[model samples]
Target chain A: MFIADCQARLAFDLLAHTWNPVLLWTLRHGPARPADLRRRVGGISPKVLTETLRRLEHHGLVTHRRYREAPPRVEYELTALGRTLLPAIEALGDWAHTHGDDVLAAQDRAR
Target chain B: MFIADCQARLAFDLLAHTWNPVLLWTLRHGPARPADLRRRVGGISPKVLTETLRRLEHHGLVTHRRYREAPPRVEYELTALGRTLLPAIEALGDWAHTHGDDVLAAQDRAR
Candidate 1:
C-alpha cells in the first residue's frame, strides 16, 4: 500500500545514517544523558549529535525527557516502536557477522 | 565481530537510499535493462539512476551484464546476496502496512 511504502522508506532512511547505530547502541542498554551518549558514540560533535537525537525524537524512535533543575538534564531512551526495530537491527548484525565473507565476495564480483 | 559491524554498516548504509527500493523493486520482478529501470522508478534522473545502479553493483547487491549489440544493453539483476535482502525489505513493508498507526503514535508521543 501507499502507507507501507512510506513506512518502509522511513525505516530504511532512518537506519541508513552512520550515527543511527551510534545512537541505537547507546540506547540498547538503557537511557542516558546526551553528554554520555555523545561520549559513547565517539567522533560525533555536539551539533551533529544534537541533530541526530532530535531527528530520532522526531521520528518517535527515541524519547527526550527534560528534568527541571538549575541546569536542565535531558535523557534519551528508545520507545516501544524503537524497541521493535532492535530485533531487526540485531538480525542485521547477525547476518552481517555470519555472511560477511559472502557479501565481500559479492562486492568483489560486482566491482 | 569486526566483520559483522562492517557488513552491518554497509547494509544499513545501502538500504538508507530512497532509490534502493526503486531499484530493488524493479529487479524484484526480474532483471531489467537500465533504461527500463529508469523509467519504472519514476522521478529518478538518468544520472542518478546510473549512479544508484553503480553503487548497487559495487556493493554486490546488483549484477550488471553488458550485451554487445547495435546499442549497448546493460541489464541489471539482483545477485544472490541482493536477493537475500528481499525478504527483509518485504518484511519491513508488511510491518509498515500493519503497524503504521503504532509508529505514528510513537512519533506523536516523542514530539
Candidate 2:
C-alpha cells in the first residue's frame, strides 16, 4: 500500500505525461540531434519536442550538448539516471506486446 | 522506437493515471470492499475511487462481485489479466525505491 505522496508516486508522475516515456525510449539508442529526433519520432511538432526535452532535462533524465559547428549542432542524450529506466520501460513494452489485444478487447466489450 | 499509436503506448496510457496503478496495487492482496479500499488507500474521495474502479473494470483489469448479506456487499478483485501486470508494477516500484531519491535530488537541482 502506497501513500498518495510516496516516492513511487513521483516515478509514476514522471511517466504520466504521454511524451516523456516516448522521448526517453527514443533516446535510448544514443544521442541524436533534435532534427534527427523529430524525423525518427514522427508526428511531434518542433515546439512540443523542445518542450518535452526541457522537461526531461529538468527531471535530470536527459542532458544536451551543443557543438559550435557550421550549423551549431545540438544533441540530446540520456543520463545514467535515464538509462536506468530503460529496463522498466522495456518491461512495459513487453507487457503491451503480450496483452494489448486483451485490453483492447475489454474496451470493446465495455463499449 | 514506438509509433504514436503503438500497443506499448497503450500500456503506458494505463499507467499514466496516478491512482490507476495505486488502486490496482491496493487490490493486489485480494478482493476488497469499496469502504475497505478507501481506508487502505487514504485521501481518495469515494467518488474518485468509484470512478477509478469502473475505469479499471472497463479495461478488464479488475472485476467486482456482489453479496446479498445483512447489508449488500461488493468486493473488487483483479482479473487474471490484471494479475499479469503485477510484475511490471513491482518493477516500477523497485525502481522508485532504488532511484526515487536521485530523481528528487535532480528536481531540487533544477529548482
Candidate 3:
C-alpha cells in the first residue's frame, strides 16, 4: 500500500508542468480548438501549446475530437477522468485567490 | 478583474513543475534538511533537488533555516502561504486515489 501510494504520488508529479494550469483552466471555462487554446492560454507559444495539449490528451486528461470541416477544427475537452481532476485545479485557484499576496511577498523576499 | 485573474493564473503555471510536487510532498510529510529531501523524493538527483528547494524557498512556499553545529544542519518548512496550498495538494492526492484507474486507461488508449 505504501509503495503504491508513493508511485501514485510520483505519477502525479510527472503530470505537473509549467503549462498544465493554463491547459486545464482554459478547458475549465469550456472546450476549445487548438488554435483557440493557444490564444486563451496566453503566454504559451504554438509549439508549447501543441505539445501541452498532446500530453494532456495522451494522459486522458483532455480529449481531442476532430471536425472534418474546411480548415479541419480540432476541439479539446476534459474527459470524465479529466473532469475528475477539476477540484484540484479549482482548489489551486482558490489558494491563489486567498494567498497570492503572501506568495508574492515571499517571492519578493527571495529577490 | 479578469486580467488580474489571468496573471495570477499565469503565476500559478510558473510555479507548477515536475520537481515542485516532489519538493512540496517531501515538505508535506514534515520539515527536513536538503539531504533528507533528496532521500525522500525518489528519482530526484541532488542537483535537481537543490534547485527545486531553492525555487520553493524563493517563492516563499518553503523556508530554510540553517544551524551551525559540527556537521551543520538546515531545516525546510512550508510558509503560511505554502501551508495554505496544502488543501490543493491533498485534493490532487484524493483525485488520484479515486480516478487513477481511469487516468491510466486514458493513457493506454493514447498509445
Candidate 4:
C-alpha cells in the first residue's frame, strides 16, 4: 500500500509540473540568469519562472548565486542533485520523440 | 519558442498525474483484473483507477480483455508502448530512491 509519501511519488510530482522539465533542460548547458532563462525557455512568464525556480531550489535541484556588489546580479544553476534528473527526463523525452506517434494514433482510434 | 503541442509535453503530462506511473508499474508484471489493480496499487479509488486505465488505454499503453464465460472476467495488460515507459519510469524511481532524501532535506531547510 503506497501513499503520497513515497520517493517515487515525489519525483513524479516534480516532473508533473508543465514547465519543470523544460526549465531543467534549459539549464542543462550551464547556469543562466533570469533574463536569459526567459529567452531560452520560451513561453514561461517571469512570475511563473520565479516560482518554478524557487520550487526547484527548495527541492535541492537548483542553486542561485547572488552577487551583492553594485547592482546585484543573480544566476541560477543546477545542483548536482538536480542534474541527476536530466538523464531521466531526457530518456523520457527520447521515448516521447520516438514512440509518441503511437500514443497519438491510439488517441485517434479511441476518438 | 516551444508551445504546448510538443511530444515531450505530452509525455510529461501523462506522468504528471500522481498514479499513472504507479498504475503502469503495477501492470508491468502481467495482466490483472480491476480488483487486483485496486489491491496492488493501493489508495487509488475504483473510479480513479478506471479513469486512469481508460486514459492509458487511449494512450495505447494498456489493453483490456473480457471473457464471456458464465462469470464474466476482465483483465488489463501493458502494451508494448506501455512497456517502453516502464524503463523510463524505473529510471525516475531509481533517481528518486537515490536522491529523494536530499529533496526532503532541502524542503526542511526552506522552512
**lDDT (CA) for every model shown?**
0.70, 0.89, 0.70, 0.87
Best model number under lDDT? 2
Is candidate 1 or 2 superior in DockQ? 2
Query: Candidate 1's residue-wise lDDT over B5-105, tens digit each?
Result: 45566656666676775577568877888778766666678898888888887777788778999877778899877777776666555656666677677
Model 3: per-residue Cα lDDT over A1-111, one tens digit each: 113246456345534675765577678767888777766655678888888888888777887788999988889898777777766777777777777777677778778
List each model's interface RMSD. 3.7, 1.1, 3.3, 1.9
> Sort by TM-score, best first: what order?
2, 4, 3, 1
Per-chain TM-score of chain B, candidate 1?
0.77
The model with the greater DockQ, 1 or 4, is 4
Q: For residue B69, what is the lDDT in candidate 4?
A: 82
lDDT: the better of candidates 1 and 3:
1
lDDT of 4 by residue, B10-110 (tens): 78888878788988988889999999988887678999999999989989999999999878999999999999999889988889998989889989998
Question: Share of real interface contacts recovered by each model?
Answer: 0.36, 0.70, 0.44, 0.66
Q: Name model 3 segments beyond 4 Å from true.
A: A1-7, B1-7
Ten contiguous residues minimizing lDDT sum, candidate 3 chain B: B1-10
Best-fitting candidate, scored by DockQ: 2
lDDT of 2 by residue, A32-84 (tens): 99988888777789999999999999988999999999978999999999999
Q: Report the C-alpha lDDT of model 4 over A18-90, residue by residue, as the tens digit.
A: 7888888779989899999888766789999999999898888999999997888999999998889999988
DockQ of each: 0.40, 0.77, 0.45, 0.64
Q: In lDDT terms, how accurate is model 1?
A: 0.70
lDDT of 2 by residue, B1-111 (tens): 477778889888998887888888888999999999888887799999999999999999999999999788899999999999988887887888889998889989999
The local lDDT score (0 to 100) that residue A94 gets in candidate 2 is: 93
Cα lDDT, model 2, residue A88: 87
